[model samples]
Target: MFFSLIFSLCCVTAWALPQYQPQYYSFSPTVGRGHGESFASVGEGRITGVRIWEQSNSYIKGFQLKYENVWTPIYGSTSNEETELLLFEGEAIVQISGKYNPPNYIYCLRFVTSRGRSLIAGQPTGNSFNFYPVDGQSELQIVSGRSDGTGIASIGAHWALIYRNDSKALT
Candidate 1:
């Protein structure tokens, strides 16, 4: 039983990151600082890890990834949704399937401060989009399903990233 448990854990750990690609190349226009660098993901539970860094020197302030429902993701086990993380603020969210249709779900992240206060926010972008969460800030979005909610495999979104324009900032 112990061996089996260990083996299962190892296997699970290995099957975390999504095999798909990324879908957007947008940065925060309001960010008075760095540009996003890259991401690292391993699709495990209902959520994965994405690393977004500081443009100046890749000082990662946060990352984005999907949360795998663990018990049953999509059709059975392979369907998982994306989640975003704002490390600077220590915030995260999971996409829960909504009661709507085709792809009925939303992305939300919440965290508390050392002082003690609930912080939660939803992903403004759909499966794929060119969005700016806060004006003058960096832009991050997803790109996998249609505008309405049809899923499509796009490598462009699997591991896609956009660098900051040193000469031309978003603002």
Candidate 2:
């Protein structure tokens, strides 16, 4: 009886374990001196995490994530890249600084899913970044200019999505 109970407990625990599937997408946008935007759409599923990279030397004046009818501002110093592990549903829109007829700027993004699956649409690389959980949606929308709407730069983005998994809700 003791052995049987232990086996049952183990099975139950294994089944309850959270499974994570990671998906990745990359985008290259040529934002010039003015304003620009980039984004990606995900199928049905929950977004567990996100990562963004700015390949250009220019500073990102500001950035925001839009989905459904809500817009969430991304807080952080103007850096080359950023990451977050916030949970979001449906599609996602990434809006960033842009320039009019500017140089070529490259940006990348990654999305982690609750399920242990991922679909990559661009080149994958080895790099370390940080991600945190925040509130937002999972849809693509037009890029609204910065608060000042006067920055000379371009933006690119990549996204990842998972189609299946067994993970608990992200608190």
**Which lDDT values do the candidates have, in the order given?**
0.28, 0.34
Instruction: Report residue 95 deviation for candidate 2 (angstroms).
Output: 17
- Report the C-alpha lDDT of model 1 over 1-171, residue by residue, as the tens digit: 999999999989889856685444343221111112222233542222232222122111222344333221221011223233322222222121111111332232233222233333334333332223232232223322212112211111222222444442222
The best candidate in terms of lDDT: 2
The residue-by-residue lDDT of candidate 2 on 1-171, one tens digit each, is: 999999999999999998773324333332333334333333234323333333244333334443334445442223454433344543233322222333322222343333322221112232223232222222222232222332314433333332333342221
